[model samples]
Target: MRHATYNVNGIRARLPRLLEWLEREKPDIVCLQELKCADESLPIADIEAAGYGAVWHGQKGFNGVAILARGDAPKLRRVGLPGDPDDSHSRYIEAEVGDYVVASLYLPNGNPVGTEKFDYKLKWMERLGSHARVLLAEERPTVLAGDWNVVPEDRDVFSAKATRHDALLQPETRAAYRTIVHQGWTDALRALHPGEDKLYTFWDYTAGCWQRDAGFRIDHLLCSPEAADRLRGAGVDKWARDQEKASDHAPAWVELV
Candidate 1:
């Protein structure tokens, strides 16, 4: 089945593009990030009208995640990471679609590095790692997809040395991402396209980032070992980044048998 992940940026703002994408791509399942809307504000009817069943979690102005399925909607398995009950970032939501377990995540954007926010980002990564372990233990077809807000390697971004001190490219963030991969998960894009570089999925809207192709490969699809074995192909929908009123990010996906 074909499954896709996209950080729509803001669902309300990108409704038109999203609708067009749904009609064109027709993926079996879609994981969305950064809804930037409250739960009540979610455009539920409009999404349903677009011909897909969806389940979502949202907060006031930042951080939201959702899952959409073309068939009968999947079972809601979990919402938010388990480590801290007080953490309410609306960054995680998981579901079962067909035989695969899916998770949509929006890991924190740790801006100013030496602050509480960065620390929280690391803690959140730990929680994700723990949750992933549990899912791996289940031995089911598991696909974790989302805007991880992490640069897996220097090659994943446009420049390695240039972004060394940046929040998303910091060593801690990369290490955390590496830790997750070490737990028997395959980084689908890299595993499938071993020597390829500059296959970025996100570009900044400020300062003509897209025009210059200045981008970062923050969004990802990490599959459990078993799921990786079924990998068919992976790609970035770069055209989405060029649409009028487009989001800074584009859709990325992997097809599996």
Candidate 2:
């Protein structure tokens, strides 16, 4: 099956592009992040009209996540990563699509270091790592797909030296991701495109980052060992970033057999 993850930035602002993508890609399932809409405000009718059923965890204007399965709505498994009582951002949502469990995540963008947001980001990472372990124990086809907000390595970004201090590319964030991978989760994209460099998933909106190809590969598809074993192919849809009024991040995907 073909599954895709996209950080649409804002569902309302990008609805047209999203519809176009659904028609073009026709993925069996789609995981989305940064919806920026409350549940009541989400365009459920539009999604259904596009031939998919969705389960979403939405926030007022910030983090949000949703899973859309073709034909029928997926069984809602959980919302938000486990392990934090005070954490209430609508940044994580998971569902069961057939035998596989899938989730769309919006990891905290820890900008301007030395702030509460940065600390929150780090704490969240720990929770996510724990949650990933639980999912890995299931030994089923599981996928944690989303805007991970961590640059896995210097090779994944355009200019590692320039972004070394950035929150997404920082040593702390990288270490957290490394720990997750150590638990036997596979970095699907890297596995597919090993040795290739400058593979980015996000570009800054300002400073003409897209034009200069100044970007970071912060979005990802981390697969459990079972799912990774079935991985057929994976890549980022770079063409989507060239669309008019395109989101800063493009769609990334994986195909499993």
Off by over 4 Å in 2: none
Model 2, residue 132: C-alpha shift (Å)? 0.7
lDDT of 1: 0.92
RMSD per model, one decimal = 0.9, 1.0
Angstrom error at residue 165, model 1: 1.9
Looking at model 1, the pairs that clash are none
lDDT for each residue of candidate 2 in 66-182, tens digit (9 for 90 to 100)? 999988789999998888878879999999998889989999989867888889899999999999999999999999999999988888888888877789888888899999999
Residue pair clashes in candidate 2: none
Tens digits of per-residue lDDT, candidate 1, 7-40, equal 9999999999998888888888899999999999
Identify the runs in model 1 with alpha carbons over 4 angstroms from their true place. none
What TM-score goes with each of the models? 0.98, 0.97
All models: lDDT? Answer: 0.92, 0.91
Backbone clashes for every candidate come to 0, 0
